[model samples]
Target: MSVEHIQNSVKDVIAYLNENPQDALSNDPPITAVMEDGLRCRATDEDGNTIVTDMPQAIGGGGSAPSPGWLSRAALATCDATRIALHAAQSGVTLDTLEVTTDSVSDDRGLLGLDKSVRAGPLSLRTRVTIGAAGVDQKILREIVDFAVAHSPVADGCRRETPSKVEVRIA
Candidate 1:
C-alpha cells in the first residue's frame, strides 16, 4: 500500500481512538486448533481464516506445514514490518524497499524436557530489517526504524513475559 493511504488510515484510527478511548482496550478473536492426525493441527480464527501446523518427521510428524516456532518468527517479522511502515507513513516518507527477517535459537533439551534448568522457549531472538527510501536521509530512516521497534507490540510481547491462563474442557 502507498504511504499516503497508510497515513490517512493511521489518522482515521487515531481520531477514532481519541473519540472512543474505551474501544482501545480489546481482545483478539478467539482461535481454536483441532488436531487432524498425528501432530498436525488446523487452527481457525473467528474470521474463518485458518493455518495448519505440524512437526518435523524426526518428531514423528508429517512435516506438512510450518512449525509453531516458525510461525512465531514469521509473526514477529510481519509485525515489525507493519510498525515500520506505519511509522514511515506517519513521517511522510515513501519507502522504496522494506524487508524484515526474524530468527531464534531454541534448545531441544528444553522442549523435550531433557534439562530441567532450560526453559521451554527460544533462548535468543534476532530481527534483521532492511529499509530504504529514495530521497530520504539515512538518519531519518534509522530514526523511523528505531521508533517502530520501540513501539512494536509483537516485539514487546516477545521480549516480556505475558501472563496466560489455560482452561481445559472435556467432552
Candidate 2:
C-alpha cells in the first residue's frame, strides 16, 4: 500500500476513535495452541492463521521449527520494523530500506532448572534499526525512529514487567 493510503487509514481510525471512544477499547481475538507431538505445537489465531513451533534436538525436540525464544526475538524485530514503516509513511518520509536487528541473551541453566539465580527468559535484549532514505532530514528520521520505538506494542511489552498466572487442570 502507498504511504498516502496508510496515512489516510490512520486518520480515519483517529476520527472514529474521537467519535466513538468506547469502540477504541476492544480486546484482540484470542490465539490458541495445542501440542502435536514431542514438544511441537500448532498455534492458531482467531482468523485461523497457524504457526508451528518446536524445540531444537539439543533441547529434546525434533528441531523441526524455531524455538519460542527465537520467535520472541523475531517478533520484536518485525514489530519494530513495521512500526517504523507506518510512522515514516504517516510522516511522508519515503524509506529506501529498513532493517531491524535484535540480540538477546538468555541462560539455559535457568530453563533447565539447574540454576535458581538466573531467569528463565532473556536477561537482556537490544534492537538496532537502520533506515536508508535520501532527501529526508536526518533529524526528522531520528525523531521518527524514536516515535516508532515509543509506539511499538512489542517494544513496550518487552520493556514492561507484566504479571502472568497459570492455571493447570487435570482431566
Candidate 3:
C-alpha cells in the first residue's frame, strides 16, 4: 500500500480511538494447534489461516516445515518491519528501501531438558535493519527506526516478561 494510504488509515484509527477510548481495548483471536504427524503440527487462527511447524530430523522430526523457533524469529522480523513502515509513513518519509532481520542464540540442552538451569528459549536475540529514503537526512531515518523499535509490539513482548499459562485436557 502507499504511504499516504497507510498514514490516512492510521489517522482514522487514532481519531476513532480518541472519540471512543473504550474501543481501544481489544483482544486478538485465539489460535489452536493440532498435531498432524511426527513432531509436526498445524496451527489455525479464528480466520482459518493456518501455519505448519516441524522439528528438524536430528530431533526425530520430519524436517518438512519451519520449526517453531524459526517462526518466532520470523514473527519478530515482520512485526518490526511493519512498525518501521508505519512510523516512516506517519513521519511523511518515503522510504526507498527497508529490511529487517531477526535471529537468536539458543542452547539445545535447554530445549532437551538436559540442563535444568537453562531456559527453554533463546539466550540472546538480535535484529538488524537497513532502511533508506531519498532526500531524507540519515539522522531522521535513524530516529524513525529507533522510534519504531521502541514501539514494536513483538519486540517489546520479547524483551520484557509476560505471564502465560497452559491447561491440559484429556479426552
Candidate 4:
C-alpha cells in the first residue's frame, strides 16, 4: 500500500491544534517504561523486550530519559536511513557510506508543564548527506535525497503524526 502524505506545515499543525483542541491529551496504549541502571527502558507490543537501555546521565531523570516520543524519532530516522540506502541502490547510485542525523529541540517545560517553548516531539531532523557513489554527481545525490524524503514512510508518518488511538478492548 502506498503511504499517505500529510500536508501540514508546522504552523498549520499548531493552528489545527489551536482550533480543534483535544478533549484531553493522553498517550495511547499506555506505552510502558522501566528504569534499570539509571536508564529508562521498555519493550514493544510484540515479544516484550527492552528496545533501549542505559540512557546517558542527563535530563535529571538519571542515566537518560528514553521517552516514547524519542522512539518515534529513532524509528523515523532509521527508516529514512534504510530507505536512502535502498533508493540509492535502486537508482543505480553506488554508495560507500550514507548517514542521516535527525534532531529536535523541544521545551522541557512543555513536556513537564514548566516551559512554554518546548513542543511535543522533535522540532527538526537535520539530514547530512555523504555519498561515495562512483560516476555519480552531487545533483544525482540530491535527487535521491529529495526522492527519499518524498517517499520515506517514516518521514511521512512523523509528519502525519500517525498516532494510533489503540484502544484496549475488554474481551
Which runs in model 1 stand beyond 4 Å of their true positions? none
Tell me how far the alpha carbon of residue 11 in candidate 1 is from the true structure, in angstroms, after superposition: 0.6
Per-candidate local distance difference test? 0.95, 0.90, 0.96, 0.64
TM-score of 4: 0.62
Error of 4 at 88 (Å): 1.2
**What CA RMSD would you report for each candidate?**
1.0, 1.2, 0.8, 11.3
TM-score of each: 0.97, 0.95, 0.97, 0.62
User: In candidate 4, how many Å is residue 83 off?
Assistant: 0.4
User: Candidate 1, residue 31: CA error in Å?
Assistant: 0.7
lDDT by residue (1-171, candidate 1, tens digit) is 788999999999999999999999999899999999999999999899999999999989999999999999999999999999999999999999999999999999999999999988899999999999999999999999999998999999999999999898898
Separately for all candidates shown, the number of backbone clashes (residues 3 or more apart, or on different chains) is 0, 0, 0, 4
Residue pairs in steric clash, candidate 4?
Answer: 55-63, 56-63, 107-118, 109-115
lDDT per residue (tens digit) for residues 89-169 in model 4? 666566766777777665556766675666755666665656566678888888888888778877887677665676575
Best by lDDT: 3
lDDT tens string, model 3, 1-171?
A: 899999999999999999999998888789999999989999999999999999999999999999999999999999999999999999998899999999999999999999999989999999999999999999999999999999999999999998889799888
lDDT, residue 10, model 1: 98
